[model samples]
Target chain A: MTEVKKTYKHYVDGKFVRSESGKVYAIDLKNEKYEIPLTSKKDLRDAVTSSKAGFTKWNSLTMYNKSQILYRLSEMIEGNKESYIILLQDHGLRKNEAKNDIENSINTIIWYAGLVDKWEQLTGNLNPVAGEYFNISHQEPIGVTFTLNSNSISLDDLVKSFLPALTVGCSVINFSEKNAVIALKLSEDINNSDFPAGSLNIIAGKFENIVEDVGGHVEIKHAAIYDDISKESKTIIGEKGSESVKRISFQPPTSGLSSILPFIETKTVWHPKGK
Target chain B: MNNWEYAESIESEKIVKIEKKYGHFINGEFVSPNSKKYLDTISPSSEEVLSSISIGNEKDVDFAVNAAKEGLKQWSKTSPSERSKYLFKLARLIQERSREFAVLESLDGGKPIKESRDFDLPQVAQNFFYYAGWADKIDLAWGSEISKPYGVVGQIIPWNFPLLMLSWKVAPALATGNTVVLKPAETTPLTALLFAELCDEVGLPKGVFNLITGDGTTGSELVNHKDIKKIAFTGSTSVGKYIQKSLAGRDVGLTLELGGKAANIVYNDAALDEAVEGVVNGIFFNQGHVCCAGSRLLVQEDIHDIFISKLEKRMQTLRVGNPLDKNTDIGAINSKDQLDKITNLVNEGVSDGGELFQIECELPKNGFWFKPSLFTGVQANYKIATEEIFGPVLTTLTFRTPDEAVEIANNTEYGLSAGIWTEKGSKILWTADRLDAGVIWANTFNKFDPASPFGGYKESGFGREGGRHGLLSYIKASS
Candidate 1:
């Protein structure tokens, strides 16, 4: 009897769909191979439109609701840990190593899940100005973030690429290349986690195919690269992003308070103390 | 009725001695530029050439950057406490000579002496003193997560706040253990030149603080210099975007304090008298040359008539004239170029059919000037309503609801600062939370302190310039 094959597609706006371009890239695993959807510029634009709307919906929810949703992602990942470990093994890891990577990835998700509701406190403060005015400097999330995960085949790297941005109220478009099989497979649990439709998107493709569009899309707001792209790509991103003064970060911190710093804007409110 | 006028009490310019010709200050000494070209720095009020400052070319900027790079070794080697002492000493010296710097600032930058004296000079000293305390305690401020300096910094300041902007950029960079190559706006380089002298007086390590004076070309040189690890620019949005594009693909840090058309919203519940005063001060301060100046007035519809009447009455009382005059409420326009820009925008606003109200004032024949102008019945699309006039030109719009006010206030691409006036605390918080601006002033406007972080959201630019947050601008966290 022939084994039933699993189909891999892009997960965007909360549903699993093939790239609008209908193009696929082949990734050869240790013992098996799979062809996954390769995202196009048009697909990226569609993702941006969805993320922009998703930002409003996701950001409007109560902090408690958002935090629970993130925590639920961890639950979903834990429930399917065996599958993730097997998938990581198919991507060239030993069984023990794959299990360890899955365990680490789950712990990362939990860490970000706990941080979802409280990262603002660690990043903002009530500025102590010497006057009779109530001046406080708080923070707001920069919206519609595009994060590129490193090409390393580890699930932990894939999770770190988007979690910090997600933890701060920003809707993330998580893009992946060499690590697409792991990222695309993991999208199953992400779909199960109940993220607001456009809040968290996982797309797989050749980054070179849509590098220019990633930087030029005014609505993206921010482009954070965790992977080491060529100097040419970095230059292209910076040059195009300058037109809109977009916030772009390269290899930003992955843990602690600073990890979320790139995703926030500080806003200070001043009120006079008078009767 | 004749408006009440006070006798002119002109401030003395004798305290500051101006040099006929000035060169770039590099390696703790004045050095002639390799370009051998100079631009005459003028007193914008009188149109008198105060001095000729060297125009820094690529070679000159390279010299300054190289000096800063060489200085980095010693600056990095200096003990944090020792660095703190130097900054403390500079602050003390500034306080003692505050009168001198104030005179020079007004002479060079065309701001009222009352402001340059009571506001800019004091703030400059306070900034240095504030950052001095942070020199040794930076680890405590953020964390020990490897907050290390970006070895050499390039700072470009605008003409509006000349010396104060210098203090804003330089003090923090030095406190964070970075060497600086600073370029002051060509129109107002005297006070920054004077600041370089103080750096020498404090016996700071040679090459630690380098000053290169020139036009936009010079600033581009500094931004493109290979040795500059970070660039902190306070200027127009267009120029900031140009600088950002120039540094593309490079591993250089940038923080821009750019243009803003901040909305000052007055709800009906606000104390009308106090709100009127704030609205006047918000736009008229520094001839509205402030980047974060409240240029757009969003008034609650029901009270719009009453608010405009009171606002115009208060504006009529503003005294416009010489920067040196102690009682001058409005000084000369910063330059002929800026005056023309404001005039063109105002003319366009009139053509666009908005009502224009100019306070009755006689013109000073010698220098650039503009009467305090107000526009009413303005649609959001008018140039005066949307663009940053960057002068004492205020445009008024009316909104019916708090949500509508927030929508109108955030309609612009710029989000540097905003003002909200309401009697209710909950309403103030609600409006502030919804507005996209970086700084929200409730029942108040134009307030600043060393401890408060100030920057913008969206295209108004990025990165805070003051308080604990500012340290991040000069330092990078390594993993």
Candidate 2:
């Protein structure tokens, strides 16, 4: 008798719950198959609520503290490379390709870890005016982004979208790719790290239906659709997102397997130090 | 002679005078050019010298940019309400001096008085007013995050609607807290110089808005300036492509609102009277110089004859005369080079075996004029149909079905805007869905509001202006 690997339900608000829709998608790995639970609309809403609740305290943390937490997450991801490689291989990646995927995924998190303190220098500044008063500009975070992970290189793509947004202190309600078992395990690692509940939530489900449901919800401040699909699907996603007028970013085909550094507000506090 | 004929004959006797020796607007004053070199801007209407405007070289652009960089610090620090007050003041001043601005726009750009007064000036004022409300409410503009301005925007405006395009560029850039170094079209530099004087009168802070006047060299220098953070341009597709290629590997952000060969479809079920009005307004508006003007009329084959007949009759009624006239419908082409291009393209249509139908109205001999023209039996592959004529020329093609209409509509590389005229609600929605242009209009043509976002897809350009999306062009996405 052969042993089978078991799939688990999503964790939301520090609790693991089965999908309310009672639906699951099967992940095929070579000759083997496993049932991965799909998150329901209710689960998505719960995740958003969790993220929104966790945003205030996470956003209030000092940049230095946030940087340390992100660095810790990166370290954990690096330490667990073999498990991530096996998970990637299960999702159709060959051995060498899976190694590259895991390496790129961990590197993305580490890259953002390095950028934690430099964000302010890059985005915020004081202006020089011919006046008596001082002028300062800061970059601030947008709240609770609803991100869709691209089907290609699922773990790396999910990490690319998640880390930069988290590094800037914005919590994310992320919809990972349907076959992204590795991303789920990565989320578990995140939970073990100092990342609080609701700071990051991962779900897996039907791409079109679940994204549409998530897009229709009002609390999703911004949404990024991350697949190369038909024009009709783009329109459907665009119109669905207009319900809340969510800030949408359509990723073009040939978007690299690297994370984009999104702009965040970095408030600089300056006082008369000499005085 | 009839009363109208006598009035027209008398108005033709008076010659319009062109100015000389224009100055640059820098550091809150009309200052001498950094370089003494000047360019002679010719009046396209008469091929006469309109003005000798100071041509800003790289040195002038740098000076204006430095001024803007200096002002950016102080201006970005002001409270949103305080910023809103300044925009409000500028908007009121524009409205108060609307007549002067309108006349100056007509004199420099050769657009008719009615358009400059009724359409251009009012919309310019409204743009400022609309963005004024946005200044204090930028928090709402972003997705629950406070928006910050990009530093020192370099803007280049086109000659089609000089002051109107300037207002579109300036108002939104200012509202979002970015200071600007703007370069108006060299041919139509008068109105922009006058706008600088108004800024001074309104006590807008020094170095907040600087105007540099020159041709392509000046525009190129401004775009390549290392200190400038973003570039917003409205102009030809060729020039836009050049700018994009030039900035390929650089970090300078760009928002281009470029040229278009928009399609205006008229179905058999469309209201004939309204369709005729839309066709007239579509092609002849601004003498068809608009980037989003409906240059291709895709009428359903069933209603092709009737629509063209009505359009021809309506075109005959349009008054093509002096731009200063209160009743002129079509004005002179903006320049002699533009007039020659219109003539060359229309000649090509005739040589290519398409039937030419001119409006049977006589053109003035002294000014740069071309009678409004329509080409029947125009193929989708014809040069007249594919290229942007940017003149009062319409190319007519017929489509058999709604899907065919959409096929012909999306055939062009430019996708700035498209129009659909049909009484069926379902078809309107269907066509709007398929048309690849940024804006799709039903039962109307060329209607714009500051609340509505406007831009093009594909080669027509990227990025948008107006509405919440307009705010995105000036601010970095994350901040």
Candidate 3:
């Protein structure tokens, strides 16, 4: 007897729910049947709103607490690595490719989790500004970010963008057009982990709908798009989002201190350092 | 009220000579612009022509850029110690001639001499000194791998803080081993011209630092220049957007320090007197021409009446007169056009049913001047509350709760700077955390240091201009 396939739905507002349009698309992996909720533009709006609300809660946590939560999520993913490898292989990865996918995804999460509490020191400073003022700059998250990945991107590449933004305290709304099933499974791991609800919203749908909806949302401070998407779509988001000065970039950093810097802003606070 | 007025203590301007014609500084020397055009820069306090500065066109910008490109080859190759020495020399020279620069700053910029001397010139010198220290140590500054400098930086500064803004741009760019071509604002070019003389006096290498004088057209030419590797601009939001759009497809770096309508929040548990002083200094400093000035006053509803009364009484004591006067508390507006913009916006605020308050003071007739005005009982949507008036105008709004104050504060499109007044330490940190601004001054206003990273989020622009992050604006790190 065949085991029953698990149905996948859009994760929004810390809950798994069907698309508002009630549309579902099938994902066929190795002749095994899986279904993905077809998220619409309205769903993107809801996810953005939820992600913004999530940003406040997540950003309020201390760096230590955030680091703990990210670390816990990586541990959970590592504990379930065997299952993830099976999932990747079932989704079309060869044996080595599947193992490598699970391994890299776990390592990316762990790397960013370790960096969660330390990035500020790498990017911030107590500036000797030539005054009696104790001036210091601290890197702060830029609020909710909208991330998009191509249809052909591996689960590891998607995690690379999501984890860095998450590590920096920014809540993310990711639209993965090609690998929604695996992305949804990762969201389940996130929800089951110590992460607050709405912190990581995963939507499976056409890239155009999500980008267009993100264009109108002023609450989204930054958007990281994998350049695999069309240039016209990127231009549309850039032009429509220009009113709010949304930082739209196709050059997503893959590694280094800058990988997390793009997801945050620098805040300098000044007070009198008087006797 | 003071029944007797204090005697005028006008600072003498005779220490500095006014030139009839000023040429652009290029390749370590003053050269006539290729455009062959000149515009008169006048004293905002006297309406007297201080000097005629060259109005550079595209060709002139090209020449300046080319000079900077050649300068870059030498500058980028110079040892960090040599760069540090040049900047130190510039800083010391500025200090030795501080009075001259101060008088020229007051004359051409219409800031009170006390400010030009005490605040502007000192900060200018300190800025150079601070960046001078970084010249030899930039590799270890950014906390990353060794970074390389971008070539030929084009900087455009606003009129409000002419010399100080120039110091902020040039000091860091040069410290990072980049050559510069800078455009001084059309209305205030004297101090920058004076600065160029110091560069020549210091025997700085030819083509290391070039200064071109012109209007917005010249700024656009520099912004659109093909060879400039980076653009650093401090101006309005609209122009910042235009420049960002112009460089949409290019790989050149850009950092903009744009406009702001920052909100100053006063809690009921605050020290009301100090808060009032901070509010005044916040908006009235620089004739309210400061990009990060606290233009919106958000007071708790409980102390709203008492705070307004105290603030009005304080505003009344501000002396608005000749900028050269040491006794003058409020100086002339930067320009006639700026004064008109302030007048129109304040008028609109009054028409929008906001109560208007102004200090009754005698003003000089010849130059640009406006009463330090206030609009109370303002709603969140009032134009004066939302827009950057960029003059000595403050709009007062009241909120009953801390969350509401944060809501109103973050509602504006600009988030450059914010001030929080409260004795409660936790509340200060809490409010500072939520406000969208880049710089938060707790119980202080308009305080800047060369080490502080100053810029804004949203429409106020991108990239920090000071501190270690500031060096990143000029340097590119290898992956």
Q: Best candidate per DockQ, number?
A: 1
Q: Per the 3 Å backbone cut-off, how many clashing residue pairs does candidate 1 have?
A: 0
Q: How would you encode candidate 2's per-residue C-alpha lDDT over B1-479 as one tens digit per residue?
A: 65555354212312333357877888887777878989987656666676789888888999999999989888878788888888899999999988888877887788888898898999899888988989988866553343667889999999999988898899999998899999999888888888888889888888999999988899999988989988999999888867765554355777788889888989899988988898889899999999999999999998888888888888888888788877788989998888899999999998998899988777778879988888999877889999999999999999999999999998876778888898886887778756767666677788766655677755677667776667778876442
Better of 1 and 2 by DockQ: 1
How do the residues B1-479 of candidate 1 rate in per-residue lDDT, one tens digit apiece?
59666578988988899999999999999999999999998888899999999999999999999999999999999999999999999999999999999999999888999999999999999999999999999887778884789899999999999988999999999999999999999999999999899999999999999999999999998998887889999989999889888888999999988999999999999999999999999999999999999999999999999999999999998999999999998998989999999999999999999999999998788888999999999999988988999999999999999999999999998999999998988999999999988888889999999888988998999999898888888887767
lDDT of model 2 at position B432: 72
Q: Which regions of candidate 1 deviate over 4 angstroms?
A: A1-4, B1-5
Q: DockQ rank, highest first?
A: 1, 3, 2
* Local accuracy of candidate 3 as per-residue lDDT tens digits, A44-65: 8898889988998888888899
* lDDT of each residue in B209-247, candidate 3, tens digit only: 999999999999998899988999999998887777666
Candidate 3: where are CA atoms >4 Å away? A1-9, A16-40, A83-94, A129-131, A150-153, A178-182, A204-216, A226-235, A273-275, B1-5
TM-score of 1: 0.98
- Each prediction's Cα RMSD? 1.6, 15.3, 3.2
| Worst ten in a row by lDDT for model 3 chain A | A149-158
**CAPRI docking class of candidate 1:** high
* Candidate 2 global TM-score: 0.68
